[model samples]
Target: MKRIESEQNASIKQWKKLYTRKERDKLGQYIIEGPHLIEEAMNHNVQIAHLIIEESYQMPHDWEQLRLDPWVVSKKIMGILSDTEHPQGVLAICRMSSKELQVKAGGKYLLVDGVQDPGNLGTIIRTADAAGLDGIVLGEGTVDVYNSKVLRSTQGSLFHLPVVKGNLQDWIAACRQEQVPVFVSALKGAESLHDVQSSGTFALVVGNEGSGVRMEIMESADQLVYIPMFGNAESLNVAVAAGIMLYELQKNRK
Candidate 1:
């Protein structure tokens, strides 16, 4: 195995570019860390560019026989490339192609509005997968779906569904075209989520943790609903609210 000991190694430099959104966009490649995400990508049959591993990290049984690991890297170099606290010891740079995210809600769709927390976004992606969402749309100002922390949070589940990035107005209009009810989570004039029955084909618009959905988007929603807050605490995390909404939506789906 070719070892990359020098920090200035060309491949190392290329992988470092994964940290930047610009570079990731330019290359159409994003970095994925840990065994879980790698396995997830594989299970999803997404194209794999390079599989990098440290000498100490054992390659998975499936990976060992594959054409992966074009090169071996050092712990230090792997550390430099990884973004996690406890690095997965293995990493892969994957090429992502558009999954053709559809706004027409056939089953369920999650529309995120400027959610910045990586963990929150990741959890939401995982939740969406569990809920059997048809797709997810990231409105402008929303966190990058490929962000490292968000990627880690998803634990490879992001591969399960179609995720698209665009403005809310345009996508919501498309949903309306498909006759899907739009449900917006709002703090005011919002009906109790339990009181309102979820439609089979529906879209859930989740706002930012601090600021709710943009006024324009909220105004366009067919119905605005709120999760009943029994406790005295303030609103729930954007992701938590998303999970609840998905739970209810999925419960009604089946």
Candidate 2:
């Protein structure tokens, strides 16, 4: 195991760059903080580029059994590497999956359109995973899935399935070509959510927090569906609405 005490250390400097999306994309790597996320990544067979631990942390015996060789850093340096208020004393640098998933016919999919809030995007991704969807396609303007808050909100579900950054319009075209009905969430000129029947395979398109799905994307959707609002609430949170729709579509499969 190596020890890195100085914040000026070259390795430390490179690790810190992972905090930015641009750097993460350029390097094709991201940091997963804490034990649970690390474990989830391990279970998913994610490649660990490197492991960083607080110098004072007593390395867990079970962790030692793994193939990882950790680099110990001072707590002060850990704070610099961590985005969280409280550093968990453990973080892993992991390579992003190089494999891009092609949208397949007869598979369930969630298409995220322009959802800017990290928490909402994370929850939606997690919900999609829970619903047994094949994968999620993140369209233009969606929050960066690798952002710390978004990653935390996902609770490691991102590693469980194929989550691809993509163009929604192109995906819509692909879905149409594959005969995978694409449903968009819209208020006006949309069918009631309860009324649409799913063929056990389709793509659901959800959009921005305030504006909802873009008009161009909506026009391309095989259909537009809306959740009925009963109370004085203006509308459901995008995450909540996504959860409702995802499961409802799953039920249609049954």
Candidate 3:
């Protein structure tokens, strides 16, 4: 094991760059803090490049059996590497998966379009995982899936499922070619979500919090659906709506 006490250490500097999306994309790596996320990555077989722990933090004995060599750093250095206000004292640098996700026949997926909020995107991902969806395709204008806040919000579900970036138009086309129904959520001129029978195989498209799905994309959907609002409030949050829709679609699936 190596020890890093200085904040100016070269490795520390490089890992700190992971806080930015550009650096994560350029290096094809991202950082996940907290022991739960790290353990989740290990459990899911996500490639972990490095394990970092603050010198004062006590690691569980089981972690010692892992193949990874831990690097002990001072709390000060960990603070620089941590994204959270309260540092968990543990973090891992992980390599991005290289596997390409294809939209296959009879598979379920969530097509996210222009969702700018990190928390919402993360929740959507976690919900999709719980719903037993095959994968998530992030459409253009969506926030970077590797964003720290987004990663934290996923609570390690990011490691449980495949999340890839792609063009919604092409994905929609591919789903249709495979005979998978494409359902886009919309505020107007749409079928109530309750009325549509769950096909067990589908691609549900959700969109920006403010504007909702793009008009052109909505027009391209095999069906447009909306949740019936019984409350006095205007509408559901994107993530909440997605959870409701995904569960509805998945409950009847074999």
Candidate 4:
């Protein structure tokens, strides 16, 4: 294991740059902090480029057996790398998967559009995984899935399934070719979510917090469905609405 004592270390400088989306994309890697998320990455066989630990922290016994060859860094260096106010003493730089996912018949997916909040995007990913969807499609204008807050918000669920970034229109076109139904959530002129019949194989589209789904995409949906509101609340948070719709759709899956 390497011991890195200086914040000026070349590797540490590069790792710190990962905090930016542009740098992360350029490097094709992202940092995940906390023991739980790192463990999930290992369990899921996600390629971990570096396992970093603060000098004072003790690694778990099981982890030591894996021979990860972690870099031991001073507390100061860890603090510089950590995104959280309270550093967890451990984190990793993981390689991004290069696999491309396709939208096909007989599979269920969640399509996100223009969700700018990292927490919302992460929660949507977590909810989709919990609901047992095949995968998630992050449409253009969605927040980067590798954002630190997004990674933390997912609570390790991101490792459980494929989350692909792609063009929504292309994905929707593919879904149509596969004879899969596409349901877009909207406010006006949309059927109540309870009134729509899910065919077990469909794509559920959720959109921006302020503008809702784009009119062009909504118009392309096979059905536009909205959750019935009994209370005075005008709308649901995108993540909450997604959770409700995902479970409801999954409940009737064949």
Candidate 5:
């Protein structure tokens, strides 16, 4: 296997480029740092461009033989490329696959509207994947999915779901094209989340943690739903809200 000891190596520069959204978009590639995420990506047959491993990580006795032929690199180089202070020593660059955004009429989907935090975005994606939602629609102003922290938080769920992204109005137009009902979540006066009655497919819109859904989108929603909070706190985290809502939506799905 090749070794990337020099920080100045061309490949190192390319691997480092995965840190920025522009570079990730330009190349359609993302970096996974933790060993578990890397293994999941490999096992799922995601397209891996390259992998970097630190010699000090000491190959596992059982895994050394079957894992991909990884390039060994110095710890300093890992520090330079990894976003985390404590680098996982094993990082892999993988390509992003295309996802379908449009849903069939009355189909199920989760719309992440204007979410900005990478960690929240990642957790939401992981939760949505686990809930068996058809896919995720990341509306405008959402965090970059390829952000190192977000990708790490997803724990490789990014590979499992169909994640489509666009502006609020544009996604709404696309949903209309598919005849899917849009359910927006709001803090006040909205019906309880479980009260919504739907015919076929539906898209749940969970907005930013601070602002909630935009006024325009809320107006367009077929129905607005609110989660009842028993505690003094106003509401739940976006990811937590997503989990509750998804469970409510798919409680009886086969």
Candidate 6:
């Protein structure tokens, strides 16, 4: 019911800061666009700092009865909030969930190494959720999971899983401490995916788009494995490769 028409409104200025990762870190919040992502955040009980809607657009029927009233903004202001070519006219400011990753005995985990593509990272997260993995550890060079493109590509799966950032070496050591075998996906001097059997409790490391896993991490892995490529194509997209490896690792467990 509250309307903000001025582009220079103090609240609007503060909201714009969310567009950058630094500001998001400083403010402890990020923006999620469209109805689906908003619904996902709401369902997860993530703290909704603000529910912002374009002034010309009517609030969704389901949202009107919510305990929080939507803050209406001018269409010009909505344009500033939107990152996409076609604005969804609805967006939310959501607090980041506290990091929930801890290596446990007999747990299945995915370790990502410097995966820079937002879409690929998002797909990998969705795949991990579908595979029912315990959690995902994102190494230093990985893209921010909160990146807008990555968020959109996740299709709400990110909210369904526990994802946390960590140092790859520390994570590897923790897994080893728990007796979980760590397997690195590599292109050379590695066993085939078919030849590598999961130990039930294991950690799978997927790497960068072009460079693959870092040499140091690969060397530290309990074993290195590669997907068999019989077709003309040289390699698989990092995301596709991840999906295959994760599913195969769990295939015989049941």
lDDT for position 186 in model 5 = 94
- Inter-residue clash pairs, candidate 5: 106-200, 106-201, 107-201
State, as a TM-score between 0 and 1, how close model 2 is to the true structure.
0.96
lDDT of 6 by residue, 214-245 (tens): 99999999999899988899999999999999
**TM per candidate:** 0.95, 0.96, 0.96, 0.97, 0.89, 0.95
Better of 5 and 6 by TM-score: 6
Question: Residue 15 lDDT in model 3?
Answer: 96
- How do all the candidates rank in terms of lDDT, highest first? 4, 3, 6, 2, 1, 5
lDDT for 50 in candidate 3 is 90
Clashing pairs in 2: none
* Segments in model 2 whose C-alpha atoms lie over 4 Å from true places: none
lDDT of 3 at 220: 96
- Model 1: per-residue lDDT, tens digit, 34-53? 88888889989889988888
lDDT of each: 0.86, 0.90, 0.91, 0.91, 0.82, 0.91
Count backbone clashes in candidate 1.
0
Give per-residue CA lDDT, model 2, range 48-122, as digits (tens): 999999988877777789867999998999999998999999999999886577777898899999999999999
How accurate locally is residue 95 in candidate 2, as Cα lDDT from 0 to 100?
92
Q: What is the lDDT of candidate 2?
A: 0.90
Error of 4 at 28 (Å): 0.4
User: Model 5, 28-138: lDDT tens per residue?
Assistant: 998888878877776777888887788787655544666567788888988888889888888888888765566666677888889888889999999988877778888
The TM-score of candidate 5 is: 0.89
- The ten-residue window of minimal lDDT in model 6 covers 245-254
For 67-141, candidate 4 gives per-residue lDDT tens digits of 889999999999999999999999999999765677778989899999999999999999999888888999878
Off by over 4 Å in 5: 58-67, 198-200, 252-254
Candidate 4 lDDT trough over 10 residues, lowest sum: 245-254
Off by over 4 Å in 4: 252-254
